[model samples]
Target chain A: MLIDQIKTIINGENVSIALFFIGMYGLCARRNILKTIISMSILQASLVLYFLSLSFHPLNVPPIGADLNAYAYVADPVPQALMITAVVVGISVTAVSLTMFVSMFHKYGTTNWNKVKKKRGEIE
Target chain B: MRRRVLAVLMCIVCFVVIIASNKVPTSDDLPIATYITKNAFAETGASNAVTATYLFYRYYDTLFEALMLLFSIIAVIYMSIHEGDKYDE
Candidate 1:
């Protein structure tokens, strides 16, 4: 029952809202660039979960070959199609952001944003 | 000191608001479990709805996402390695 409840929650809008807040918390709370990147990844995963949940329909047979008329449910294909694109884009964005974080760490010798900013000012 | 106290009070109020809003679900809300179970297999060819949603319909997106994660790892490693080389020089 708990699993079912969780499934329901994921399928609904709450997961997306939760992820958005959590991601914001990570971005705002963490001083380390790596943690921020990890948080961003988590945020992206939330969206993936949200989109994937939309494709479900109870008691439906796989779309391979079934009695369409007798079937009690039909799956939503559009969300599934859209989620694939979201996953890929999320990955690319995470990759680029992390790359920038790593480069910043290298240049400043510290991952803390405040220190990095100070160091950049010194360099200029 | 006044600003710090105000900030703490604000944080507590926000926390309380979030907690209060998460009430028990009513019966009228849509039964997502039933919906998922009914449509999952018929819409996507996967037995598992989660798998079907992620791998089948969104396979290309998943593929690119994995690639992007790989790219991040590579970039981090590259930057660190380059930083080390610069130190040696």
Candidate 2:
């Protein structure tokens, strides 16, 4: 029953929203840019999951070919399409964020957000 | 103190709005997964809907995404090496 309830909760929009909040919390609370980037990646994963779930139809088969009558379930293509873009974009964003983090680390010799802020303040 | 109170109030308002909007629908309310079944062959020649979705419909987007990843890596490398030179000098 709990599993069913959990599934039900996940089926709706709550999963994505939860992911967003969790990611935001991680990004906001964590002083390390790497951790923040990881959190953001989790957020992106949640979006991917949400979109993929949206495309699911009960008893659907892999959508392909002329034999539509043979299968009871047909997979949703839209989410699949969207997710491809999402996955790619996610990787790109992660890469960019990570690169920025590395640059910041090199410039300041630290990964702590507070320390970086202080260093910048000193420079100013 | 005022700013902290204001932030808390904003947080409360956001929480209330989110909770109010969090309505879950039953299975019957869900959209019919017909698009993949109908357009699988035309859009993506593959039989697997997942594959078609990634390869055919969003191939260009995927490529650009990969490029973005590459660009980021290059940027990181460039920055690190550039900074290393400053220390060496």
Candidate 3:
């Protein structure tokens, strides 16, 4: 019961943070270049989630009502707005990274990090 | 052995994150947020406070974001074009 209450009290940020670490692990531990790119996108998504979560409250309306005073609770709009740009940038970055990976796969003939390094004469 | 070590380290990092995130108060109570919510409709003539903030207060950031996307698109095109050329040869 105590643990459940604590879970209820835990901030939404905890979920985002966990996602971040999952992404980080994938980025560090994965060998495939595509998987690494996927991990990077996952990290970006977690950041977006964190920002969106920052704007939430238990019973808040969307910040779109004409009668501003009618609503006792409204979510923070700044984080929501900021995250829109972040999401766009994340998409752009992922697209570009994937394109680069395609180029690299063509050049090196392999997606595995160690194999690519060996083929390219890079020290691991 | 290396994976076990990394897993332990990751667990420690996750614990630190939980502790740090727990300390941050989870409430929408900032004074600036209050001001934005109250006056955004009047200042920007938009019912949506988030839209007003992005389109008016921080429009420059949005402009740069667009430019960044544009450049990335150009880069991808150029990179793929060279690959095509190499294939023809």
Write down the TM-score of model 3's second chain.
0.69
lDDT over C-alpha atoms for residue B19 of model 1: 45
| Candidate that would win on TM-score | 3
Q: Report how far off residue A101 is in candidate 2 (Å).
A: 1.7
Q: Per-prediction DockQ scores?
A: 0.15, 0.37, 0.64
Q: Where does candidate 2 stray beyond 4 Å?
A: A1-7, A10-12, A64-66, A122-124, B1-20, B24-36, B42-44, B50-60, B66-70, B83-89
- Measured with C-alpha atoms, the lDDT of residue A93 in candidate 3 is 87
* lDDT by residue for model 3 (A11-95), tens: 6677788778888888777788898999899899889988888767789888896767678888888888889999999888888
Return the top candidate by lDDT: 3
Could you tell me which residue pairs clash in candidate 3?
Answer: none
Top of the candidates by DockQ: 3
Q: Considering only chain A, what is the TM-score of each predicted structure? A: 0.75, 0.81, 0.91
The lowest-lDDT stretch of 10 consecutive residues in candidate 1 chain A is A62-71
Instruction: State which docking tier applies to candidate 2.
Output: acceptable
* Docking level of model 1: incorrect
Q: Give candidate 3 regions above 4 Å deviation.
A: A9-11, B4-8, B24-28, B83-89
- Note the clash tally of each candidate: 19, 5, 0
